[model samples]
Target: MSETLTPERVRADVAELLGCEPAEITPGENLFDRGLDSMRVMILVERWRAAGAASLEFPDLAECPELGHWTALLTGDGA
Candidate 1:
């Protein structure tokens, strides 16, 4: 995992994965419900897990519903 997962980096990564503009993602909105399908979510989670073995916790991922939460997990600022 990166030493610190910044919000800016999260925004960029998510946008790239979704193939959309970063502004399309709201900070506190629920991304899955907003259009991030199960496949995408799984792929994202797996990617994070692969990025570093200790980089992700699937259960904690459930509580993360938006860019803010996702960024927190990636950066270890807390979930």
Candidate 2:
């Protein structure tokens, strides 16, 4: 079964990339501003795609760079 993408999951992924606590990743905060790079973003894309988010892409997450937005996009609740 496909894993569901939740805000907490998104936060956890971002936290792993940033090397910080999940709570440090606020929903509306910009990930890039918090030190996220292309490499880490691609890592997240690959991980999520493997988890069944087949439609996810670098630009989709790069353009938004926010936890809530990433969660919505991954969960198919956003355009």
Candidate 3:
């Protein structure tokens, strides 16, 4: 079975790329503004997909680059 993806994991992944603590990523803040570019997003998409979020797409994140949004998408808490 694949490892379950968690909100913390999502935050940590993005934080790792940003070179900062996961807690520094505010839920509602735009990650792009925080230095997350398309290339980084593609990386997260692939990583998350490998982590069990197979349905995750680049557009799902690119259209809404927020920690909360990503967390919800990865954790299946969003509509």
Q: Name the top lDDT candidate.
A: 3
Better by lDDT, candidate 3 or 2: 3
State the weakest 10-residue window (summed lDDT) of model 2.
70-79
Model 3, CA-based lDDT: 0.88
Q: Which candidate do you rate higher for TM-score, 1 or 2? A: 2
What lDDT tens digits, residue by residue, belong to model 2 across residues 1-76?
Answer: 8676766677788899899999877778888999999999999999899888888889999998988789888775
In the range 1-79, model 1's lDDT, one tens digit per residue, is 3433456666776787788898888778888777776677777677666655365656565676678777766775532
Pairwise TM-score winner, candidates 2 and 3? 3
Q: What is the C-alpha RMSD of each candidate to the true structure, in Å?
A: 3.1, 2.4, 2.0
> How high is the CA lDDT of each candidate model?
0.69, 0.84, 0.88
lDDT of each residue in 26-72, candidate 3, tens digit only: 89999999999999999998988998888889999999999998888
Q: What TM-score fits each model?
A: 0.69, 0.87, 0.91
Give candidate 1 misplaced runs (Cα > 4 Å).
Answer: 1-4, 53-55, 77-79
Relative to the unseen true structure, what is the C-alpha lDDT of residue 30 in candidate 2, on a scale of 0 to 100? 89
Q: What is the lDDT of residue 13 in candidate 3?
A: 93
